[model samples]
Target chain A: MDITDNKENMTEAPVLLSVRGLVKSFDGKTVLDGIDLDVRQGEVVVIVGPSGCGKSTLLRCINALEPIQGGEVLLDGQKIEKDGKNLTAIRQKIGMVFQSYDLFPHLTVLDNITLAPQKVQKRPRREAEEEAISLLKRVGLEGKAGSYPRELSGGQKQRVAIVRALILHPEVMLFDEVTAALDPEMVREVLDVILQLARQGRTMLIVTHEMQFARAIADRVIFLDEGHVLEDLPPERFFTEPGTERAKNFLHMFEFEAVR
Target chain B: MPDLGLNVLLKGKNMQRLLSGLWTAMRISLIAVAISMPLGILLGVLMTKKNPVVRAVLRVYLEFIRIMPQMVLLFLVFFGTTGAFGWNLSGELSSIIVFSLWGTAEMSDLVRGALISIPKHQYESSEALGLSRSQTFAYVIIPQTVRRLIPLSINLITRMIKTTSLVLMIGVVEVLKVAQQIIEANRMASPNAAFGIYLTVFLLYFIVCWPISMLARRLEKKWKD
Candidate 1:
């Protein structure tokens, strides 16, 4: 449980992404109220909580995928605004992988991966395709270039979704339960890809339902409850010695999950 | 071996007139399709906008077109316009105008349905990838929408083609008109000319529409897989 090495590293690294007093609402009902967070460079922070705790909304607000009622998300000290002049540029720097993979059904795996780099980044087609093919190879999808999304397995599609976001070379990644939709047997493959990404020192903010996976990959674990951060600590500390009574009860809900 | 009373089709010049008449029907639908496709696409895009006036106007246009029969619209454009405006419009030209307006409305509705049918996540995924609104439309939204639209639009085309028989009411000598002419002229020579020639006309329509609906079904089946 000794994570002092990680703690020392966290203090020295600059904050790569931060949310400041973020407030979000839907139809006048508050979902995330006065939420603040900081994710350092080369860090992986996982957010977990009971359903409707606003973890997904927080990630979406970071990506500006949802309209925020108040406050801001910043990357590399620059504010990420929904209507900023350079919003698209800022959006490209914050990659997101969704629960459903959301691959374009009409596009081949290669096209899905290479689209943004070629279209938005204006990278050369040859270069983009070469990189995408190699990345596809790295994700163990060696020769699926021409296969459509419908042709791939859920795990394979999720891996392709990761590559789709990664090809843009974002500063940080936001994963909203990427494996939640995968078949149980397939979930390991997608999680393994994410674990490898963490080993390579990618800054990521993840929302996941897999408690064990969250504990294993996260440098920091944030427990959200009732529209605010209830606990933020090193996974070692938070898992072992969760601060609030709420956190303990939340942990208890997962204790009875039977392994099949 | 009777050819189902289809002997009327082979009579001197009757077959040629039917083919030419079929061509007349095609000309109206084809021109309408060509003109309506782009405008329909634009109007369909406009329909997605949340502006009150745009929604109200498009809704009114759609209801007007759907409630009023095409024959009534044809009458309005062909006879009513000519009588009121004192503009001499040929029957064929009048048919073309009426069909074009009808096709535009149908095409636009198809486009709107296709556009809205696209899942919201597709738009989100595109935007999250740094695609601008226009880029998302061109790269993601439009491609997916068009895929959904093709089968439906082909079905629409088939319907419009068959409905061209209505143009005869406006005095355009399309296929139905030609069939009537042939049946009338053969009344003395062939007792069953009405049944035979009308059957031939029905076969002609079947030949044109069958392949289109088949293509549409094939497309839908392919997408499902």
Candidate 2:
């Protein structure tokens, strides 16, 4: 199989987010080590690896959700520091959707979406509710606004979570295995929303196990193994002809599973 | 057996003393609840802090209150303070202070449990949404904690009310104290007055606490649903 590299396309676009020599550890165990990458505006970067390979940790570190032992992250050329002044303001520009959805169980769906806008952004209640309603309608959840998180299916909850993050108008979106916890039947709807976002030219960093979905959406695919970025190539090259032996073995396992 | 005691109850000033005593008990408990709830909640949130020194201090205070009997605490505040500190505190004030201390400790534990019970994901999501620490607590953490705390706190309020009966030992003239006074006053005319007066005190306590217990149950059920 012949696969062309899109490295030229990446170099021409303006980078929206960048990571430099990122390192993270927990309880003296290194989870991410010497990671470096760039995500251009309108780029959809997908990260794939086996369990405990630090895919989620990298995303979390980028979002400043996890503390890093070393290195730095920049959003639109501004350094993102964990203890920096205006950290909350910095975080406002990045949105993250977790695997569990993590909707506030005590709140209605509409309230869940509007909370950050009204409270953090200082938007008027009426304005926030109006925007939330429209967002919900766009996601086909208009009638379910009054319902609780428990009242919604996994797909609906995940969609609501996406909407909740989107309402902030984040510069970049991070999806950490958003569909890993969803039922197989429900995964499509959530993924469909993400695809729609991708089509709209939104910058996204996604960690996923769905190889076909990664190929379908990723401009670039990063293969991480044991806290190292083994391969960073365009989707075609990463899939058809992985560079490192580790990448090749990883893809081989996936192909074997597909055949089985 | 009941004829003389019944007469004593209907007699002038006897019923009035009991009612006045009940009023005193109610007032002290309500005041303690009002004062202690907020203080307890603050202490409770502090209890969950990462600072070992602060947590250790709160833990010691909480454990001390839990293990020391309420009656003993009442005496310590009422008599010990008067002797050691020379403050000359009234029985009513002493009761309030003792109960408030106990209530604050209990409330803090409840608040801490409620706060800790909140899943870590909620805080992460709140932070990700750009909410500051205070904003997260106000909008997310506190609301859920309050819901979990209401039933338990209400039950504590009822316990405080009943425990105020100990104030009689300090000469507060609460219901039990009034019952003793009436029994003593009518010892010649009403030999069984003690039984009837004590029964009335028990009935009054039951009437006050039973409704509160029911309300707590109802709240627990409603919030769970």
On lDDT, the candidate that comes out on top is 2
Tell me the whole-model lDDT of each prediction, alpha carbons only. 0.89, 0.91
Instruction: Provide the lDDT at A52 for model 2.
Output: 96
In the range A52-162, model 1's lDDT, one tens digit per residue, is: 999999999999888898988888888888888888999889899999999999889999998899999999999999999999988999789999999999999999999
Worst 10 residues of 1 chain B by lDDT: B1-10
- Given candidate 2, what's the lDDT at residue A103? 95
CAPRI level of candidate 1: medium
Can you give the TM-score per candidate against the true fold? 0.94, 0.90
lDDT by residue (tens digit), candidate 2, A94-168: 999999999998899989999999999999989999999998988889999999998899999999999999999
The digit string of per-residue lDDT tens for model 1 on B148-215 reads 89999898899889999999998899999999988888777776778778878899999999999999
Quality class of the docking in candidate 2, CAPRI style: medium
Best by TM-score: 1
The numbered model that scores best in DockQ is 1
* Deviation from native of the Cα of residue A60 in model 1, angstroms: 0.6
